[model samples]
Target: MTILVEKPVLALEPKDVSNKDDSEKEMAAKNGFFAPEINSFGNSFRDYNAESARQSTVEEFYRLQHINQTYNFVKRMRAEYAKLNRMEMGIWECCELLNEVVDDSDPDLDEPQIMHLLQTAEAIRKDYPDEDWLHLTALIHDLGKVLLLPQFGGLPQWAVVGDTFPLGCAFDDSIVHNKVAKQNGTTLPPAALFIIRFHSFYPLHTAGAYKHLLNDEDAKSLNWLHIFNKYDLYSKSKDKIDIEKVKPYYMSLIEKYFPAKLKW
Candidate 1:
């Protein structure tokens, strides 16, 4: 399906170094290339280094995530959440709700969750202007993190945010939190769902691990996931987005792929 999305008037411009703090300047310098280098904190993106203050808390979050995110726990959470009874709201409403959320598990960003979502979607939109479904996919990919909110059962950060891996299989070494634990397309294509579900499964896509667990369909979906990962991981920055200016554009895309209101 060809989704019609109005391009927002406020383009996401490059950060002006003159206005940035020392750390932000350093980060902007590192992000000079398509694939940026270590973060401004001088730690690799998602580094989780034991001694680095910026990464240490993230490491601890992973420690808890690794121990608790077992097959049974995943299964139970799926069963409970699959009911979709938390609340009913439009996709944009959910996006606005994320303005109050922060991902404690992320080492790269401390901003509100909506910024990351918009940043990723806008970055992908700029590069793949014709792929409106991909743009919408990027916007809603992390809507699942709404589980962290009180109305959604108030799940801990470990349960909602952070990199995700498969529960039925062994954790792969390439996954960032290995030391601790562990998509869609056009009208929200099947490929887009695959990317949203498994982007954090770095072992399968990035590391060439876990081939044994994937069937033929999964193998095919892996290709799109690889393409999606670049924008998802590398689009993050210290730059702020003007939500009021961009909200109309994303709201249009959300209307295309999803109902006005979705079950939580």
Candidate 2:
């Protein structure tokens, strides 16, 4: 499919990034984005070892996830959800459905799934206003979490959301872009698809794992994913987005990139 996207009004010039610890904050500031110093829990972002009430719950969830997310198990999940036989709904409808879900593995966010989606998208939109495709990509990236709903088999939290990584010989799982949007015939660019598919892959993007596995295309996609990941990780707060106000804007993007109704 030929995906149409907006041309950036100003091409970002590459900068010689300093190895200083505050590089990320400096970069965000340069790009007209602000990176908060702490997360909603008054802890640093993605600090899994932080002492908090949610710490034990997050650790336990990871324990279960590591144990059960085996190669064979992921294969089964891929085949099962590839069917996309769950139901037909538009992007907005799926977003509404996700409001009932939350990610137990996310130490930074305990908000409903929809809030994170909007938070991430709005943050990106503010910083990169010309990138409409990116805004929509952020919005729908976690729609696959609907698998946790009863109508979609009510999958366990461990299986549905977390920092995704490979268990098999190669990387493949029932991620949003891999199993949902691509299967449903989305015309989003490869970069948008990459962000949708691997935004939770903290080890690769954040910890610098699996760098050797990246090809030329994966390398290019990783740059965009890196930019997207910051907002996805840090935008989680008690702040509320006015859904009714932003609905029309995202709906227009949805109509541009996706069919009115999709199979699950």
Q: What is the C-alpha RMSD of each candidate to the true structure, in Å?
A: 7.3, 5.8
lDDT of 1 at 97: 88
> Candidate 1 lDDT, tens digit per residue, 69-125?
888988899899878777788888888889989888877777788998998888777
- Each model's TM-score? 0.81, 0.85
Give lDDT tens digits, candidate 2, residues 73-177: 888998999999988989999999888997888888889999989999998887778778889999999988998899998989888988788775554443212
Top-lDDT structure, candidate number: 2
Backbone clash total for model 2 is 0
With candidate 2 superimposed using the best TM-score fit, by how many Å does residue 46's alpha carbon deviate from the native? Answer: 0.6
Which portions of model 1 miss their true places by more than 4 Å?
A: 1-33, 181-186
TM-score: model 2 vs. ground truth: 0.85
Q: Which pairs clash (backbone N, Cα, C closer than 3 Å) in model 1?
A: 66-181, 183-192, 183-193, 183-195, 183-196, 184-191, 184-192, 184-193, 185-189, 185-192
